[model samples]
Each structure stands twice: as C-alpha cells, then as structure tokens.
Target: MDSHRIIREAEGEVWVSCKIPGKPTIRGSLTSKGISSDEVPEVTASEEFVVQEVTKNRITVSCPEENISCTFLSPYASFSHIHEKNVSYLDISSGGDLGVSSSTDQTFKVWETHNTEVKSVLEGHTRDVFSCKFFPSGQEVLSGGLDSLVKVWSVNDGSCLATMKGHRGSILDIAVVADGQNVISSGQDGTARLWDSAQGACIAVVDDSYSPINAIAVAEVGNAVNLGSPKETPSNREVGTEGKLVVLAREDKSLEGVSLHSRQSVFDFDGSDAFNCCTFISSVGVLAGGLDGNIIHVDIRNPKSAVETVSWSETPVLSLVPFRDTYVASYGNGTCYIPLKGSEQVLQLTGPNRQPVFQVAAWKKLVYTCCRDGFIRKYEIPDLG
Candidate 1:
C-alpha cells in the first residue's frame, strides 16, 4: 500500500487538497457555518503539481506547465484496515484502541483497531446479533440481537456478565451512558428501553411507538435542557444524567427524542420517510436520516421545522456520525457523504462494494464503517498542514 496523507489547516475556514496514488486529485473545503462559496477551489490532478500559495484560510497547488490549478480542501479520510465479515453493527471504544463488531454470522467479536487483531469472540445469542457497542469504560461491551436480549460482556475475558430480556422483537440499537452504568436500546417491537448494565435490569420503557424503532442514539444535551417526567425516576444514575436523551429513528417516518433519565418524550418530528438512523451533532442540534435518502437537521428546542435538509443520494441513510466540524452519513448504496460547512460539494467515502453500510463509528480522527459486504472499512483523517 502506498502511504500518503492530505493535510488541512483552518482559519475562518479550512482548505485541503492533495493527490493519492490510485485515486484522482482530491479537493474540497470545510466550514463551520454550513456556508458554500463559489470561490472554493476546483478538483484537479496532474503528473506533477507544485505548492503555489498558502494562506490562513486557503492553500493552492498547481501544475503550471499542465495548466491544472486546484484549490480547496482535499479529502480528509483515507482507507486504513478492513475487517472481513458481513458486519451488521460496530462501535469504536472511547479510548480508540478497540472495536466491537457484530456480523451476519451471528457472532460478536472484539478486535484491536490499530493492527486488526481479533481479541475476543462473544457468544450467547441464539440468533443474529444486530448491534454491539463499547461501553464508555471500554472494558465492557453491550449488545442486542434478534434473540430479544441485551447482553453485557467483559472485553478482557469475553465472559457474558449479564443478559437482560423483555423486548418482543429484535433489538435494533444500543447506547451507553458516559459512566457505563446505564444502557439504552431500541427495537423492532416499537419500544425503546433503558437498562442498568451492572445489574442487568430493565430500568424503564422509554417509549412504545407501535412502529418499529429502527435505530437509536444517546446524546448528552445541554446542562439546562429539561425533560418532563416519568412514572419513576431512573435508578443508580450518575451525575449529569439529566442531560441525556435517547434519539430514535422509527418505522413511522418520525424522528423522536426521549429523556434517558425521565423516560419522557422530548420531541417527535415527522420525517419525509421512515427514519433509519439518528445522531447528535451537538447538544442542541440533532440529525436524522431516512429511507428517502434525506438527512434532516433540527434544533431540539424548536423542532417544528428542520433547520436544514440534505439530499445526497436515493439510498436509505443507514448511519450518521459527527466528524470534525461536519457530519458523515452512510447510505444503503454504500455511499457515504461527509459534508463540509462552506463547501457545496461533499466528500465521498470510497472503497465500498455498493453494499449497505449498516453503521458508522468514529474515534479521534479515525472513522469506521460496517458494511453488508462483510467488511469493516477503516479511514483516517490527516493532520493539518
């Protein structure tokens, strides 16, 4: 493999451009304000290009003799490692050392992200394991599956510590609190529930939508954000637990938010189509992607209207992840878009086999995508020049 890195620097906006061995000349720009400018550079490649100019907000490269000039940000992520198995869901640990992946093979495994070494194989689910994630502690893992059970495992020994059961349908997604004591899950049975990871007890049913809940995310909202009330307060919770919300993507074509602690509905916004996944870009801003290939951004405080709707491809959006100053969305067609605020064009994640990208997880500067092609594609963001 050829080693190359595209460097970027930020001023008011960041500009990046570079050339890769087998890929075309990469170019683009990223802004924090979601503004696009025509002044942005073009994409070009040549047998040779020279660094022509450098500015706080811009970098220019040109092949003077070939008359090729391109300016703007270059691609930020490059292919890293690939794990072979039809991955259904995956998450990187907070410390960025390990990854937990669940596959169509009905197995869940833990691996070292850096050198691609399989560390532990967790077994217990009788059916397909649909979701798996690293706890905030990174020493444990949480997984849910078609077996209608949630299992907690020790990352070091691969021993199943606890299994919580109740959902009538396949478990779709799982999220953990910052301290790892609590877990939140959504399922095909149209219910979202919170679990006490330590004791393996169902704390409460957060929602019963009557429509399959396709995906879920746990986000820590602003300290002052308020959620109404539940029948009972969640137990054994840590400090700052009041600020957490469970965002759900439902089969009813709606994006919903429920307080993790209160088990109360915060907001439910009708979407253009069935929501496939949801995530948070910040405490106040939430994003949901749907089967209509549209990704909608809304302000939690005023969700009467979407702040912005981005239509990238016609494939169902399977995953959304916050990346740097922007966010990345992956689709059923294996197309992934990383939107730069000020750039009209988005960065595309390449190297897919046109299979469904089931999940996306990021740790530090590295991004990981689990695909139906039985591959977990890894990408790394380059350092700034």
Candidate 2:
C-alpha cells in the first residue's frame, strides 16, 4: 500500500439484503467516507452487517410478504435484486449475471441468482469482505475490505489475478465507473486513489480532508489537475470522459477533492464533523453532502478548489446525491431534495431522528440507511413528484 493512503473516517452504510420474521430487511452498514480511520462506535456491538449469516457465501434477505426468495445464482455477475443477504455486495454485468462479495470463508462468491448456485470462490483479503464489483465487461471483478487490499479476480476461474496496495488501513468503500477501465477507493487513510482497472496500476491520488474516505467519487478529478495515468488512446479516452464518481467522504468536519487520473489533491472544504458518502452529478458541476451538518458544493474549475456554499442542517448529514439532475442530501432527521438549476428551495424528508444513513447509491434509486433504533430502510426515489 502507498504511504499516503491513510484516512480518518468511513461513516457510510453497509448494505445487506435480509428477511426479518417475514418482511424484507436491509442491514445497513456504515463505512466508506473520509481519509481517516473509523471512529469507535458509541457502542462496540454495532452490527457488522444488516444480518449475520451462518454460512460464508450466503446472506439472509427478506422479501416483502414472502418467505425469502430462494432464487438462482450465476457466474461472475450481479443479481437482479437490488439487495441480497449472504451476498457481501452485488454487481451486474450487461449480461445480467451477478458478482457478489462475501466474508463467509473470506472469499468473493459468484452465483446464478435464478438457481441460487455457486459458481466459483475467489480467495484473498484477510478480514471480512466489504464489497465486490465486476468490470463492465464482466471478465473480472474487484473486492476490498478490512485487511486493506484491493484484489482483482478472474471471472472465468475465480482466481486471484492481481492486487492494488495503497491504503494504510481497512478499505471500506470502492466504486467502478460504468466503463470499468477505472476504479476509485476510500479508506481509513483519509485519502482516495484512482487505479487503472485493466493493469491494476495507481493513476492519481486525492487528498481527503484528513479523514478516512468511506465513500468516493471520481470522474475527471477537477479539470486535469493531473491525469493519473497516460491518456487512454482508442477506447481509453472514455476513461476520462462521460463518466464521473461522487465520493461521500467519511470526514467528520471537512471534505476535499482529488484527481483520479493523476492521483493529486484537487481541493478541500471545511467540515464540522466527518462526512460519510457522496456522488457526482456532472449535470450541475456540483458535489453534495454526507458528513458535516452542511450541504457543501465545490467549484470544479478553480485551482484552490474548495466548498463554495453550504446549505445548513440541523442534524448530522449522512449522504449526498444528484437525483434527476438535481441535488439531494440525507440527514439524521430525514432527506432533503434540492434543485441545482434555478432559484429552487430545498425539499426536506420529514421523519424521525438517528436515521443512520450509510450512503446514497444512485444506481439503485434507493436512499439506503439504518435507523438508530436498528431498522434498515430503502427510500425509493420516484422520477416524478
């Protein structure tokens, strides 16, 4: 791992699909935020997952009004269901097969969800597997965790192909672009690193606001601050265009920016407490909240890149997201949806307090979080008001 990969916070969510007595439940986990080690929970017995399973490559997810869907599993691919238990994390390829990360025996598990069969087991990562995502092509998959190494595995045989060592502590968050040529990661090291997905090389590094990165976002980390690797010729140009990642830095008091292509510090923002997770909405030239009580925005064009403005909050801010080309933030009280374009006012989600929001996964269109009282929630975002 690189010496600079240290961070201070990973205040995001850990997601698992499980079944309660009869209803569906998602054990929301908190990780993937800033550039520092995660803080000790107010209590030590905070759940590690949404549910604890007896078997390694197996999770327990509850379907609404059903006895849990005992379905099929496939090759190195993602499941059709947004959430599944015993499955660490799920990734779907264009082909519809599912790739899953599991900590059962400390291996990445692949399956056919339709039949619920195991395909292959990838071995590595000393601790529980945090997440597993497949390449856009589905030929390979990436897994990360507490042991602090990102392992790339071959989908064909479930073999450990290569490893990218950069973080100094546990790796809590990992995200792959739609193209799969690049990847972004945040951990206890308070910094984020961009890597070449194909060669497994370090491209650029982003300096987080002295906190562990629980979640990360990388698109063109701030206007060519540095191109982490050489420009992608042929299909490689796509590596720098069209795709972007919005990281929810798990910092308690601040946020920063980095160039995934060059791996350099792009900018920073002041925070009151560590942030948890975030996402990029290129449509607005803005990045939103997850940590502090304020929803901060960054100006991607300037050299001294920092937060431009912040929407004040009354509770702990957990996640930031760009929905329908607008901006949204989830907090301890509820969710607030904001429009970035005009003189629009922010919309708040009225609810109870201590809604432990782990992160906002844009792809699922479901704002997933955990309640302080111990119930997981998946807030579905509707396209229409």
Candidate 3:
C-alpha cells in the first residue's frame, strides 16, 4: 500500500487524490477505517494502493502492496496576514485585488489582497479611524474618523485629496453614491449627510433621525416604490438619487429608512435592542442586527413587523456580509453565522480566538474578516458542484 495525504476533510469524512505513475490521478473519499480497491477510481496501475492515515502534511498509505507516503499542500497558505493594531474596519476593492483596512492605531493602510503586501499607509487622520471604504471605481478611499472629518485619499500615491468637515461628532459609517460622484456618511451626531466628492462640499443632510446612526446601507429602489420628489431641490442631480433608499441602523434600537433624494422617512421599525449593523440582502429585503442577540429581516414596504428573526447566540451581532443566497454575520463572542433565507441549518465560521470579529468583506470566492485579535483571516468557499 502507498501513502496518500489528506487533501480536504469535512464532517467525519476525508478525501485524498492520488497521482500514480503512467496513469491519471485518482480522487476518492476514505470510508470506514481504510481504503478498498474499489474506492480508487480511474487508477489502472498494477500497484495496490491503500490509505493508512492522513496527517497534516503526509499521508501513510499502501501503494502496490507496500506502504508509501504522499505530500499535500494547501493552495491558500499565502493568504493570511496580521495587522500591527486591532483592525476596526475593512473593505475590499470591487476588482477583488486591493484590500483596505483601518485600525485603532489611528492609521489606514492599503495592501494587496492576494499576497498581503503593504501598498501604502494613508496618514492624516488625527484620531482613530472608524470607517473606511473604496469608491466604486476603486481608485480612491474615503475614511471618516474621531476627528469629526471625512477625508478622501488617492489610492495611487497615498495623498490626501480632500477633507470634508462638518460633523460635530465622530463619523461612524460611510456609503458611496453611484459613480463616485457623491458620498454619504452617518455620524454620532445623529445625522447622515451627503457630499459632493468632486467639489468636497455638503450637498444635503438626511437628518430625519435624532438617534446616532451606527450603520448605513444604500440600495436601489424600483419604480414601484413611492419615493416622492424633493420638495426643495438642492441640485439637478436629485433625479439620480430618487430611486434609492438609505437604511440606517440607529443606536436607539430602531431601524430607519430614508429616501436618498427627498430626505423623507420611508419606514422605521423598533428592534430587540440597539442596532449595531445593517445590510441589504435584496432591493426590498433588509437585515439588521442588535445587542439583544436578534437578527431581524424585514421588507421596507412592510416593515411594521420583521419578516423573520434569527437568534442563534446570546452575543450581540457586530458585522454582516451578503453571500450567495444568504448572509453571514459576526457576533461579539467571536462567532460567525451564515443563515440562508429558507433553510433551518446555519453555517458557523469559527477561528477568531473568542475575540470579536469587527468587520467582514467578501469578494469573488474569498471571504475576509478582521477580528479584535488583530489578524485578518481569509476563508475560501468550497465549490458546491
């Protein structure tokens, strides 16, 4: 019997693929305690191969009636790196190649997503940076900090392009408008303000809510929804912002929706506790998490009650990212859950050393997470087929 290493393991089953000389590679799962001759498919070699044990790097199996060893290597072994300080926020570029992170060390850094090489350190924020995001074009970065200012930086040269100030308190979150021409920010001062990125001026203030907004999500609203026209049009660009709604997770245990153009309250629903994060699963379907260990999914048109409520852990949910056919959420207890829309089984992601996962970002086949442990963990999704 020849030795074959374990390639992938899930549940109680282990899988190994073997490449025999002068024959095609054989892939099969180990059943019972050892491998049977029938388990190896497409192997026409005269040697008898049997798997004994699959360890971290080498597998001891029998090949041609003799024990031999096979080596295994992970493809994603180079995708992990640690930041110098605790990362507070993280975002990946739309192209899935650039990664941006903000830390409690009062600095923001951009790096290559694949190799984890530092591209540039964006410096200028006098206080802790709370929120950072890439524009749709991925050419610039917008960050808001405890200094009560929002700064835009050039991704190419790490130069501060513009700094917009007006918030009386720290900016908690930021949302980029379409085409990177405008942006919106939510602050601890109980306001969500819109800005003109090119002119670096405040376009409008969506201040319908008196509670400090913790998170903000912008989604396109279809023509079916009634988004009234602006009563006092500030700019001709008001038409472009009409068919969108800005969802806000407030510190007062309420989830509010405001029309992006008209600045009118669309709907508001009270949650189990003060909301920490919010996101849009679809144009109409929204999800929000709070301190009471509840994640509420609601429809904006009929948000009088939650469409569904998910409660898996007693810890507060801190972050959320939309995945294929479902959304993944991270909690204060270092637990992450992927709850599908119509399934009872929830996928749990663990490996944070019981530290809080501060933020999560997904791009292509990889999911990136930043934790209080100061490490950015990347997970690769298995091919379903």
**Maximum-lDDT candidate:** 3
TM-score of 1: 0.78
Candidate 1: residue pairs that collide: 16-73, 16-74, 17-74, 28-73, 35-342, 85-374, 86-374
What TM-score does candidate 3 get on C-alpha atoms?
A: 0.79
Model 3, runs deviating above 4 Å: 1-82, 237-239
lDDT of 2 by residue, 193-235 (tens): 6677667776656455466676666554433343344244324
Candidate 2: misplaced stretches above 4 Å? 1-123, 154-158, 194-211, 221-252, 262-265, 302-316, 327-357, 364-381
Expressed as tens digits, the lDDT of each residue in 247-306 for candidate 1 is: 888989988888876777888899989998888898889899989988999899888999
* TM-scores for all predictions: 0.78, 0.54, 0.79
List lDDT for all candidates, in order: 0.73, 0.50, 0.74
* Model 1 C-alpha RMSD to native: 9.4
Per-prediction CA RMSD (Å): 9.4, 15.7, 10.9
| Best-to-worst lDDT order | 3, 1, 2
Error of 3 at 201 (Å): 0.7
Q: Look at candidate 2 and tell me the lDDT of residue 266.
A: 46
